[model samples]
Target chain A: MIFRSLLAALALMFVMSTATADQRWQRVEAVTQALDNRVPELEGLSLELPLVAEDGSSVSLSVSFTGSLEDGEHIEKIRLFAPGNPRPEVADITLGPLASPANIATRIRLSETQQVVALAITNQDRAFLTTRDVRVTVSGCLVGGGDASAMAMANPRLALAGSARPGQPVTVRSLINHPMETGLRPDGQADDSIEQQLVESLTATLNDEPVLTARFFTGTSANPYLQFQLTPEEEGELKLAWQDQKGEQMEASQAIKF
Target chain B: MGNLFSDHLSAVLWAGALLGVVYGMIAQWSRFCLLRGLFNRWQQNDSRRLRAFALAMAVALVSSQWLAWQAGINLTRTPYHPGNLPVVALIVGGLLFGYGMALANACGARSLVLLGTGNLRSLLVLLVLGIAAYMTMSGVLAEFRLWMEDLYRPTLPATDLTLVTAPLGLDTETGRLVLAGLLSLALTAWALSSRAFRTSPRDWLGGLLIGLLVAAGWWITGVLGADDFDPVRLASLTFVAPVGDSLQYLMLSTGTSLRFGVTVVAGIVAGSFLVALLTREFVWQSFTSPGHNGRAIVGGFLMGVGGIMSIGCTLGQGLSGFSTLAISSFLALAGIVAGSRLALRFSVGSSASH
Candidate 1:
């Protein structure tokens, strides 16, 4: 029995050491799947993250791409992944032609000390990637183990900036407050009891035509906040719609005259 | 049209400039240089200036602690109290900065004040220092700085001394308050112990007021500077990065918006120039010789690199970082003292030496 126990203990140590590396491999595989199994160049993408995070609930992250786009190619989509969370995919952002390459910033919920990766896909089906390791300590805000608070469904708020000039880009900032309970969080009892209830899909529309859309996962921070630019061809009311994992929807709209 | 003067970022910038002006004026009035304080205390057996610094530290400690508690500001939010300890970089950087200050005869903060007083020598020092700082911070030398930072990085259990009292069953606030209070008391007592320091009213005022300003810096950045949608980066007075930032801002104003650090640096120059004019202390000063110029260049470069590596200069690490009671600050303080002592010992009153 003692010999068996020693072997089990040694196995545990091996598993513990290799866990992070395994997660990293898994992250690459997930990104590959997202890119239709096309291997990325692994350059030009700059993923910025603090080496150590004092807060797990709301850690700021930014990514920028540096390489020049070819004559016939532009970035199609940029995706963020936090593999340690219940859902690895954090955000999927589609860029307009005028959007600056790789300029994206948002907060993420890190389940633990884990690697975050950003993948940028070009129109030519080429991919560029970058990664950063963030160490999350004892959380600075809400610990992940209390009773999942009832989705208060805090009112969604929106701020519109820049003149709504026809054919000119206008910046829209919006937030919908929610606990964003990951299915992996404990519920004051056993761990991994809280069911995930995150703002899953967000869309911005002008004159009932989709301008921008994003799909979020548990890694998206509590009280999901997003900022994006939209160019309107004519005067119209801009609408932002959000849907949670439970199919609950909340939105705020602002009228813009061009 | 966007409003010109009432946004939170602008408010914070203006507050920073005002605070910087006060800092510049006081530093000029009191001749506040840590190297000079050490030199006077060691070589001349005079402790007044050193006492003033100690008192400032005490005041900064107690009041900043109180502010953190009252305002619900997490000290760990800033880089100085980050849980990881970059031991090697702090020690080497602190030593270099200390030694450079000895050779240059002023810390980065004092260099600004001197520059305002028409000291062309300080202008050279500031230029070299700013470029070197930027090199270490984000330019070519950043690779080496990052390598050194990661060489033997160890994460501490807690970010501060409160970790020490945790196992003893004391809560974090209780532990923090007890430790901070005792340290403040001890330092305050030491500052007041010297009768010479007690008699120098200017020194007393300098220490007390500077301490208050340090605490005020926390409030301005942490409280007034905070915004939900677009938060200003929480920081206080640290000359190394700000000096580099100021130089960059002058060149990149059209591309980059004004920030608290850049504005504060500008305020220091403006305030110091105004004070020098008011006090008639402005003089076009230059190096005594090419040897002196060479020494200033070397010293300035070392200070710039060292300050960036250490994450602060004397005032940055010794005063601002110390106010938070971070263990890394203590290590930095020790390294700086050793470096300063080494420089002082080697100088031998040469013309090239300060």
Candidate 2:
């Protein structure tokens, strides 16, 4: 498995180096390659972020793809990258067959000013990408410690846009309590085992089938909040499952009617 | 979608600016100011303005606590609830702010209102104040400020009145209501005790409207701006950092995100300008002498630096921050009043105070 991963990384590097003259992509190629080996095309994709961020800890991010798809074709995955961070891979989200709108919004961390990139891929092997440059400033006035890490992955809250009609895509927002601890604290935080602990996995499912699956990393902000869209074929329940790197898990569900 | 603000933050800005317009108009008409209240009471033996200010505080405290209960907005998330109290910063910063108020005879919010009424000297004060705030916040003095803040993080179990009443066997919610009710009642009774203050609709109305405005600020930011996608900072009426933020916004509007505070700053100016013109009060005033101009500049700098340290200005700390009943805010207020009194004694003789 280690050898295979190494080969995959090298292949992605070769493809990226020959793909474009834009060195910006090349700089963060390793982090971006967590999605796939193929270079992404900047088409039918939009990534919105503030031009400047006062707090590098958590900056709001929104990415959406509204491209024309072939019959029966659907989006497969979407990934976010912040190369400036200690761990650049922010999150990887997979959309299942039932999902319609590929719009997703979440918060991310940037250690310094850098270009943040978002990539989306369709099941038909088409990849679209976009990037935004964010200038981060030192937050002089930051209060409180952080979210209650003790309750990490405990309660996952979900909000759905009501008045859903058949075949109409509905927006769903999910937020779960977790520190997303980077395990990068300095000496006196009392976190002796300064190892990377994170909410490694999350999934949204309808009828036990996946609607959206996301893999979170240290680059994701605390209390991971993800907003996405889903289209329901009928009245059913959508369940969200979350698990941290420690293998601890939590589940929550919201019923849909119409 | 949560709201239009969920997709875009412009709605939040507009709402904040509208509230600011109301604030500016009311402030202009009523001459509502804490420092003015202090100066007037000290020099002219007029406690009406001070009573109005106290009434505003009482109203803000009661209404804000009420909103938090009904709206389910967590007050703990706000900066007013610092995890580890910076006691030294509060006292020192408050003292400097009070002294600066005496030097300039106005705080940051008052300066903005005066500027709208065509006081060019206010323009100078605002520019310097904004620059000085930035200097202390993120410029040369930022590192020092952070260092001091880090060093002075005194671990306090309770930081606000709600927490103070927790030991009295009441739950958090009940404690909040009990303290807020009692304190607000005390302030209101004292404020209205003076027949002069009771009869003066201008002072009472100013206090009442501004108090309601603070609560409205919480509603806009807490409810309307409560988008999971792009959330606005949970805030109410304040003039300290926002004054500095407005200046920065002017220089980097395109490059930086538009915050609710900056728009409110703009709204206050535009609102005041409109009212001034309509009321035939639009007379441009500038520093009559170099000494006066120098005082304004120094006052601006002191306020900028001091406000940043204390985490608010007269309105920000004395009223808005105080409304939260944060213990540090209480200390800061004490420091400010003392600072202003000392400045009054040293800078101006009893005869000159008037």
Q: By TM-score, how accurate is candidate 1?
A: 0.66
**lDDT string, candidate 1, B1-354, tens digits:** 115458777878888999999988888888777777787887888889888889989999999999999998877656676446788998999998888877777789889989888999888888999999988865678668767776776766676788788889999899989989999999999999999899998798888888888888888888887765766777777888888878876775654457788888887888888889999999999988787788788888889999988879888888888888887778788888888888888862433224
Q: Candidate 2 on A1-258: residue-level lDDT in tens? A: 999999999999989876754448656765456546776777788999988886677888999886687898887888898877766789999998777778989988777778888888899888887878888764312323333324456557887976667889898888887767776642113345445668888889987877999999877887888888889888889899899987998988988777
- Note the DockQ of each predicted structure: 0.04, 0.26
Residue A155 shift from truth in candidate 2, angstroms: 5.9
* Model 2 DockQ (Cα-based): 0.26
Indicate the worst ten consecutive residues by lDDT in candidate 2 chain B.
B1-10
* Best-performing candidate as measured by DockQ: 2
Candidate 2: where are CA atoms >4 Å away?
A1-21, A32-45, A54-57, A66-75, A120-129, A137-144, A147-155, A162-169, A177-199, A231-235, A244-248, A256-258, B1-12, B226-232, B255-258, B345-354
Native contacts matched by each model: 0.00, 0.37
Deviation (Å) of B193 in candidate 2: 3.8
Model 1 Cα shift for residue B109 (angstroms): 0.3
Total clashes for model 2:
0
**Candidate No. with top lDDT:** 2
Q: What is the TM-score of chain B alone in each candidate?
A: 0.96, 0.96
